[model samples]
Target: IENSGDLIRAINLNGGSTMEWLVDRGGGQQIITVTPRFDQDAGRWLVGILTEMVGAHTERRSNPPWVALRDSFVNTWELLVLVKQGMSGAFSQGSAPQLSGPIGIAQIAGEFTREGGLAGWLTITILLSINLAILNILPIPMLDGGRLVFVMLEWVRRGKRVPPEREGLVHLIGFAVLIGLIVVISANDVLRLIDGRSFLGG
Candidate 1:
């Protein structure tokens, strides 16, 4: 294929069918047969080849403040959409969810800071902040979304409120569950670091 996008599209279109290809190398023609495999990361089928633009430029360009802000919003919206799609497919058939905990976050931050310097650090910081905001707003107890849910429920009940003891109990249980999840995720992170394998076989 000419480019990576075209290659991916071609493979996806081909689905599970075997493909035959003609290759030109060193003034000789060769035939190759291959089958596409499903890739969880891209959520698509691939033939395990890397392709790039014919004449891609690596130089960075500066944009005006307004244009930069607009692009930032656009990128954030795209990320949100991607996250929504991932969440929807997280539990789908033959799909496994991958998560990073505090240790993983630290490793990622350190790697970015060392390899990409200031730009990478700032980018990761912003992403983490946005992730925290998203998590806080999820409809789970002991979070802002949980409080909002209670408010919504009270409004629907004509100002009637849930008992203080019950609300406290629910929040406590939620907090415990949250802590347990963090611990489990952290342990998984440690295991991945030790073995270089994903928790759910990638």
Candidate 2:
């Protein structure tokens, strides 16, 4: 309930009336009601509440809970690295495996289900998640981690930030590279579909 109030305040600050109303209604139902005059004030109140809750939760989870979490993350990273190396090596031996567009992925999913049962489909989903995570972490502009890198650098530099022009150029180059990769992968996927053979096998 305390966390919810903070979330509602943040939502109100962002010009969201529905959440504000809900919060108001919820507060009214309680014995002590604290009404905020401005949206920004409500947002700050909510953020403060959230900070307290998060701090408490973190303190509580600091020992044993975090150990399990750390182990899970390590296992996930190990799995990702293994799968990435295996797939890359397999593709590098010959032509790379094709990239799939939305339609292609659906087709592949249906085909996998028909050919190899539920286990094969599950494997595909897991592989796709790993691939997505790796791709997002690539040192390219316009990605979450890429932007986050810039943010870290800016913080380190204190006064200096990456110039907008340079940032724009980097993002443009990254976009072009990504597009070229997509095109090449899509072509390979199309060829594999037509020829009925894995591109890497050929």
Candidate 3:
């Protein structure tokens, strides 16, 4: 490829797949075949090669507001699809997905900020926000979706609402369970850190 961006895009499009490259190393050209693997720490596919910038190039262009909005919608939809697929895979595997608690998230934020500057920080921030929104809407007790479920039940009962005391008890129990889950996940994060494992559970 002519540039790092092109190479990265190609790799991402290929995912973890084998690829062949033709290269000239002053002794004529040669073909190299390699396979990429998914790196949990890096959160991408890698072939264990590094590139250095020989020069700097910059280009600036402005897109119409409509175009930018369209792209934003498209990207958001793609992210949602990926999240759905990941959740499906995790369920099918009969194993819990790797999760990051506060400590792990903080580590990721710092790494991204250092490695990618403002763009990287903003990207991570946006992703976290999206994830949080999704969690908030999940049909778990003590969440908005849980309350919506109750509302639906009320409608099914011809406007007969659930007893206030019972609803409160359910929410209180939910809160306790949620806190317990947080504690457990946070403890896992600490143990991973002590073992020098990636906070991302690599």
Candidate 4:
């Protein structure tokens, strides 16, 4: 590539590149080996004037486990907050949060894989786990949080407990609502994808 930015993006300059150069004289064409010159100034470097081959290989080191876990937590927490805001109409004036179901999760997982490979998969997995953990603890019927609600009520009553049948019915209805919500969100995800919309601004 003639442009340094292109070269850097194609591969790290510190790693250098093995390029084939074509030199043409009236007699014929000849191929030559060319090496890129490194510059201290950012984006101020050249690889070749006319290049036949422009490529390089790189070895990426994944972040340490602790760092990865920490980052995953931060990212998941941010995502949860964004979801909450979107659900609460916080972004009704700007970018809306992209709520996804199974299909959306799978699509996003594929994207993460394309962008970052195994690390992406691991990161998304951890984030999903975090989402599940937080969501399950929310004081909503059919969730662990819902059960906790009854337990708290029992404590407040000193010794009395809510009837098991009533609790079960409440959770049963909640389960149905959760399932219906999932179906609706999944349909939305499919529609958004069909319309070629941006998930970030959905």
Give the alpha-carbon lDDT of every model: 0.76, 0.57, 0.76, 0.68
lDDT of 4 by residue, 131-171 (tens): 78878999999999999999999999997999999999999
lDDT of the structure predicted as candidate 1: 0.76
Order of the predicted models by TM-score, top scorer first: 1, 3, 4, 2
Every model's TM-score: 0.73, 0.50, 0.70, 0.57
Q: Candidate 1 on 61-173: residue-level lDDT in tens?
A: 89999999999998777556555545444545366656788998887777777767998799789888888888899889999988888889999999999998998898999
How many collisions between residues are there in candidate 2? 1
Global fold similarity of model 2 (TM-score): 0.50
Model 3, backbone clash pairs (residues 3+ apart or across chains), number: 0
Alpha-carbon RMSD, each predicted model? 6.4, 22.1, 5.4, 14.8
lDDT of 4 at 159: 70
Candidate 4 lowest-lDDT run of ten: 37-46
Cα deviation of 60, candidate 1, in Å? 1.8
CA shift at 20, candidate 1, in angstroms? 22
Best by TM-score: 1
Give the range of the ten consecutive residues with the poorest summed lDDT in model 2: 39-48
Q: Write the per-residue lDDT of candidate 3 for residues 73-158, one digit (tens) a residue.
A: 88777667556645544554555656778987888887778778998899889888988888888878889988988999999999
